[model samples]
Target: MSDSNRTDFTNPSTFILLGIPGLEEDHLWISLPFCIMYATAVLGNFTILFIVKMEESLQEPMYYFLCMLSVTDLVLCTSILPKMLSIFWFNSREIDFLACFTQMYFVHSFSKIESGILVAMAFDRYVAICHPLRHSTILTNPLVAKIGLAVVLRGVILTPPTILLARQWPYCQTNIIPHTYCEHMAVVKLACADTHISNYYGLFSLCFVTGPDVFFIAVSYTQILRVIFSLPTKDAQLKAFGTCGSHFCAILAFYIPGLFSLLTYRFGQNVALYFHVLLANVYLLVAPTLNPIIYGLRTRQIRNRVLHLFTHKET
Candidate 1:
């Protein structure tokens, strides 16, 4: 092959992640907060899982869904933060191409699964409130198992194409990804070949997964609100809203930063890269860190059980 042609098809064996541009000197300092967030997320989710498992009364549909959510959060944070901390604290930013793509797949897959779980939880609240008599009949253990299976299958089916398409390209351009971790678009941007298909498909996949889930969740909440308002007494309304408050907070925590980051990436061409990267990291880290905290404070059963776990002493 001619030198020019050889250059056109060249692909690097590894890529470097630029932890955070212009803040390289503060990598260690930046890692502190990330480390704390990861630890909190891990501990919080595990505690939720433990409490749900040990407390027989907590084995209802809502807590079952919470278990799914906790597992997804655990997988999501574990998929990214460990490598990210390595990059920040040690300047160990070199990632093999295969490893980078593997990380991207897990990050996106777990994110989709988490979104689906939120939708399921919203539906659980909907059934419990709108059709109280039938909620038990409707959200049976078998149904919950099916929902979990479907969520995993959706993530498994939708995410691999993006990675496969990316692998087909020749990454002859700079392999320095300007982000804390391997994200789908970030890695694709490093390819020299035409990326329109991959880029458009990524957007399509986001719409395909999150768009429908968010729409259904909104619909569920809308019906829930209508029911709450129609109740005869103010106390009843307060009680209904209380039941959903934690899930509402969780939805906000999960989607707000995520949507903001997506919008910034698509439209904020002149925005600083660091701002974009920071928001992206927040999208992944903040929700998991806050989810258990939200539930612990707002969920009476979980809060009581968690307290009992800590305070109980053996005779």
Candidate 2:
């Protein structure tokens, strides 16, 4: 494992992924749960997308955000699940360096986009519940479209530099990436060259992407809570809080694990690797898997519309 004997990146046919090694022997057993989760996530998000698209009555700013979230989840799951399944099923762990970088880029980029989308969704709930009169004018379709564009722009800008920084590092000892996928720090740790720039850029990225987004989400919820408490009637207060229930659950599920993973990694905790893998899969699988269920179960309008649509199609 020295620089002198390392294979050149250009000539290598495939690179090995040093995934969780103990699971390698039990690939089939590991794959069973992964496949189930992946399928559930994909199908769930797809159903939401279809329901949103096919139902005219469900068209609104809130539903627009939900649709955007579904699409984001679909893309996120598709990006990571396939490679993971291939590794588990076919024992095909080798990946091209460029391909690995590409995977890392998309994984991080879509994750950023999903975070932005969740914030936007929370804001939509805030407006609808806290400022009902202004909600219609403020969150109109054109405004929602603009928000979507901004989310995409945010994701794209954050991704390129990270990928470029990654590509600059020359591999010395090994190309094997631990813990399933091409995580930024894991891959960079294998490089012989200084990763100071990469580490700096990663810190800046964490702040830029998660900082503002999570801040806005908190602000939105705070305003929402204030409005809820000011309501004269218990029913009104309950209704206001209920409006944000789904978004709130989704935010906690998505952000808590992610923030914990970053914190553990930055502080050099022993549990960092364990939490990283656990949370990485959470982003790709858990959030998306639960999103459709949460939305459909929490929102009566969406559920009713879906039922009606299905009834009409069948008739």
Candidate 3:
């Protein structure tokens, strides 16, 4: 409503989000699960933060990174979910042009930051397992803080250029975005100007976020695997690998949906449009919902703290 209503415009005063193309009638019904996902993400991520804050013993480099992941999950879920539900339930689909671009930037920014945190987590696990004697010395509070800063800076720096490119383009063309949120490409496609630069930059942003992060993760795991195999006993190896179970699960939950959604749009031309939109939405929302669940179930200390917190509350 705050958007200036000007019909003849470079960028239209507002853009309309279709929520999910080809599934208009199902929006009401679909809100059920989406609402539940948002709730679960909120509660789960908050619980993770709470447990990490309350239990001093659990406050280490690892939990610090987990806390970063939880915070990212919180932002990722919140950035798009409320607007999505509003669109679904209230039919309020108008987002201002600047706001839409801002949403896209933050969505991608926090998303990449999440990936960076996972990479940092992989490094943390590798250090802890591969160099047990020097784990504390290697991953001190200052180093962890620096890594956190670097992760934030990575997202902040990498995600903006694409959105900035998108922003400069004229939008005298249709302002209807077919997806729920302001996805970078979806919005870019709405531009009347030639978007070769935006499109190419978008691809660059994708690779820039995924490529090196994946490389570091792969290297960390490879070294970790080597260290585990070199151990004297199978029990020791299993225990060493076991320490990374939660992080591994968290990584899978975050990346699988993301890569699936990304590739689906790029290669799955036969897939339904609504399926792509739905998958994109899920790709955005599911990690936050699942990250805490993965950590809560798989990480022993946080699990124990969570149980203790609830049990203490009950008594």
lDDT of all predictions, in order shown? 0.86, 0.80, 0.86
Off by over 4 Å in 3: 1-8, 230-243, 264-268
Residues 1-315, model 1: lDDT tens digits: 466545343778888999988889988998899899999999999999998899899998899888888898998989889889989877899999899889988888888899999999899989989999999999999999999899989988888998899888888857889998888777777787788999788789768878898899999999999999999999999987876766797798899888777767667789898888988998999999998887654688989887776788531
Ranking by TM-score: 1, 3, 2
- What is residue 127's positional error in candidate 3, in angstroms? 0.8
* Per-residue lDDT over 14-45 for candidate 3, one digit per residue giving the tens place of the 0 to 100 score: 99999999899999999999999999999998
Q: State the weakest 10-residue window (summed lDDT) of model 1.
A: 1-10
Question: Against the correct fold, how does model 3 do in TM-score?
Answer: 0.92
Task: Compose the digit string of candidate 2's lDDT tens values, residues 163-254.
Answer: 89988877856667776778777777777788999988888988878988999999989998888899999998887677576668878888
Tell me the RMSD of model 2 versus the true structure: 2.5
lDDT of 2: 0.80
Cα TM-score of candidate 1: 0.94
**Candidate 3: worst-modelled 10 consecutive residues by lDDT:** 1-10
